[model samples]
Target: MRIEVNGTPRDIAAATVADALSELGWGEARVATALNGDFLPAASRPMQALRDGDRLEVLAPMQGG
Candidate 1:
């Protein structure tokens, strides 16, 4: 399946958000995620199913305030 991640097109074979994260090498990284412009909680990633053409956004925290 193909999904947009952070504005980039990516082809991935994943069933859930967690699977996508793992495939993107973010399995254990702390980050914020939104699917199709909706916020997706960390706890729900494991069950959040993804489909083709879904837009996913992942943002990692940065400290410097």
Candidate 2:
């Protein structure tokens, strides 16, 4: 499947959000995820189904001001 991740095009073979994250190499890292401009909670990731051309944003915490 093809999707835009963090504004870049990526080819991912995943059926769910959790699988996608893992495929992206996130692997248990602390981060936030949004799909199609909507925020998704951590608990919902495993069951969230993704479709073609979906926009996914994975954000990590930023420190220092």
Candidate 3:
């Protein structure tokens, strides 16, 4: 299936948010995710289903002084 990741189109074989993260190499990374403009909690990621044309935004924390 194809979905938009951080504004870029990507083809993934994951059916859920958690799997997608893993497929995208973000399984163990601390990041924030939003689906279709709604915030998705870590606990809910496992249950969050993904669909074609869906927009997924992933943002990682940046440390600066």
Global lDDT of each model?
Answer: 0.97, 0.95, 0.98
Give a tens-digit lDDT track for model 1, residues 1-65.
99999999999999999999999999999999999999999999999999999999999999998
Where is the poorest 10-residue window by lDDT in model 2? 22-31
TM-score, prediction 2? 0.96
What is the per-residue lDDT of model 2 for residues 1-65, given as tens digits with 9 covering 90 to 100? Answer: 99999999999999888999999999699999999999999899999999999999999999999
In candidate 2 the C-alpha lDDT for residue 16 amounts to 89
lDDT of candidate model 1 versus the reference: 0.97
**CA RMSD of each candidate after superposition:** 0.5, 0.6, 0.4
| TM-score of each prediction | 0.97, 0.96, 0.98
How much lDDT does candidate 3 score? 0.98
State, as a TM-score between 0 and 1, how close model 3 is to the true structure: 0.98
Report, for all candidates in order, the number of backbone clashes: 0, 0, 0
Question: Against the true structure, candidate 2 has what lDDT?
Answer: 0.95
**How should the candidates be ordered by TM-score, best one leading?**
3, 1, 2
